[model samples]
Target: MASGALAKPQMRGLLAKRLRFHIVGAFIVAVGVACAYKFGVAEQRKKAYADFYRNYDSMKDFEEMRRAGIFQSTK
Candidate 1:
């Protein structure tokens, strides 16, 4: 009868310890995901933009725009 009365509280303490471990694991996973995104997706986007504009001609684009009458006056 005495052990039966103590069982619920003991079970709750064990569950609380397990819950702490789960919380820590979740935090570690979140940090890992954030790091992967920063070094993977974000870095790839920056490199792609750099590669795209590497051989671009701004003057040619401006001239084309002017010929198309997009600009009302020349600066």
Candidate 2:
């Protein structure tokens, strides 16, 4: 009976707790990375919009054509 300590309930509970901690830690890291990527993409889009608006008047040759989405590449 002395060797039954290896199969005790307390030991199983401790292992389960450790596993949960590892899974939660991985989840938190993944969410952090996703948020950072979202933030960076939004900043890039804002900058592009600012540049396009600033040059709207200078690019008058294709003014109406550009507005009609003729220059957009589907690929």
Residues 1-75 of candidate 2: C-alpha lDDT, one tens digit per residue: 465545546764798899899999999999998898878897788989998888677557567677778888621
What are the per-model C-alpha RMSD values against the true structure? 4.2, 7.4
Measured by TM-score, the strongest candidate is 1
What lDDT does each candidate get? 0.90, 0.81
* Model 1, residue 8: C-alpha shift (Å): 2.8
lDDT of 2: 0.81
- Listed per model in order, the count of residue pairs whose N, CA or C atoms clash below 3 Å is 0, 0
Task: Write candidate 1's Cα lDDT for 1-75 as tens digits.
Answer: 455554445664798899999999999999999999999999999999999899889999999999988998873
Instruction: Please identify model 2 stretches exceeding 4 Å from their true place.
Output: 1-11, 57-59, 63-75
RMSD of 1: 4.2
